[model samples]
Target: MMTKFKRLALAAAFGTAVATSALAHSSKETTSPADGSTVAQPPEAIVMTFDAPMRITLIQVTGKDGTNYPVTRTDNMAPSKTFQAVPAALPDGSYTVNWRGLAEDGHAMDGSFTFSVGN
Candidate 1:
């Protein structure tokens, strides 16, 4: 038989564990040009860092007009905290980076951000 106080403590502990686990997925920590930034020269590559080791499943950079640039390759050959890719020449325009990754904890996550290139 569990006392009322003991039951409450157990429930609280369980809730905390669940909450922490829910936030264990890899999250983007930084970007090369930074999100919503404007760069003078076209970026040769796009790089992103995550809070934890992850495998990039899919990643792409698309122009605002829905044009997909040629991605040489996604540098996700290993489970790492960073992912990068060489993008074809980009014209002055707004671009968005969309990505999906699998975290070490076996959780799948996806996100996107936008940036612009200007002469």
Candidate 2:
């Protein structure tokens, strides 16, 4: 038999556990070119910063016309808080960078950002 105080304590513990789990998943904190920003020159690199270590599985840069641009990753697919990739020379256009990764908590995460290069 559990006392009323014991039941309340158990409920509090359960609530804390749920909240911690929810906050454990990593999230993108920032990007190199910045989301939704237009730059005068093409960005030399694509960078992603996360709140926690993440294993980046796939990262791609695509143009507004559905054309995919190749990006070279130097992270070797290791888990890290920051990931960077060098993209090929880009022309004046809007581009979207999509990425998928696995967070340190074993949860899958994915996000995308858009930037434009023009005067």
Which candidate has the highest lDDT of all?
A: 2
Cα-based lDDT for every prediction:
0.88, 0.96
Query: Candidate 2 on 57-116: residue-level lDDT in tens?
Result: 999999999999999999999999999999999999999999999999999999999999
Q: Return the clash pairs for model 2, or none.
A: none
Query: RMSD in angstroms, all models?
Result: 1.4, 1.2
Model 1 segments more than 4 A misplaced? 74-76
Candidate 1 C-alpha error for residue 105, in Å: 0.5
Off by over 4 Å in 2: none
Q: Model 1 lDDT vs. the true structure?
A: 0.88
- The pairs that clash in candidate 1 are none
Query: Per-prediction TM-score, please?
Result: 0.92, 0.92
Overall local distance difference test of candidate 2? 0.96
Error of 1 at 5 (Å): 1.5
